[model samples]
Target: MKLSSRRKAIAPATRPAAVKAGKCPICGKPQDAGYRPFCSKRCSDIDLGRWLGGRYAVPGEPVSTRTEEDDEE
Candidate 1:
């Protein structure tokens, strides 16, 4: 119920290591069904969308609107 600091830090290490040890990547709680890392089709697709969508990105600056052509452009 109570994890020591060491255990808390090591907790994350355990899941990925399951993969490193040849376990499922998705869910990380199921058997690998030839998904190679991911445990299921759903999680695999979710991760793919995250990477492709630019979700992890810096905040974009707002465009200035002082130019006369700004409305046309």
Candidate 2:
């Protein structure tokens, strides 16, 4: 095969388009590569705070603390 033909076939496979990053969830701003989904450290901290502060909770049924033995007693 000619060098030019081989080059054309490999070029597309080697080169890929840049991936677009999504906006920050905490704030509506473009995401930074360093902070990932968050735009900055501030936003990242805010998200962490929310989780630690019990603001974000998982949905589930309440667990029963009492047993049948407790009722008998």
Best by TM-score: 2
**Which pairs of residues have clashing backbones in candidate 2?**
none
Tell me which residue pairs clash in candidate 1: 25-37, 26-38, 26-39
Model 1: per-residue Cα lDDT over 1-73, one tens digit each: 4556665565444566554566455556565566656667777787687677677664588977688777685
What are the Cα lDDT values of the candidates? 0.64, 0.79
lDDT of 2 by residue, 16-42 (tens): 332354778888788899997899999
**In angstroms, how far off is 29's CA in candidate 1?**
1.6
Could you tell me the TM-score of candidate 1? 0.40
Q: After superposition, how far is residue 39 of candidate 2 from its true place, in Å?
A: 0.1
Q: Give the TM-score of candidate 2.
A: 0.46
| Every candidate's CA RMSD | 8.2, 8.7
Q: In candidate 2, what residue range of length 10 has the lowest lDDT sum?
A: 10-19
What candidate 1 gets wrong by more than 4 Å, as runs, is 1-26, 55-73
List TM-scores for all candidates, in order. Answer: 0.40, 0.46
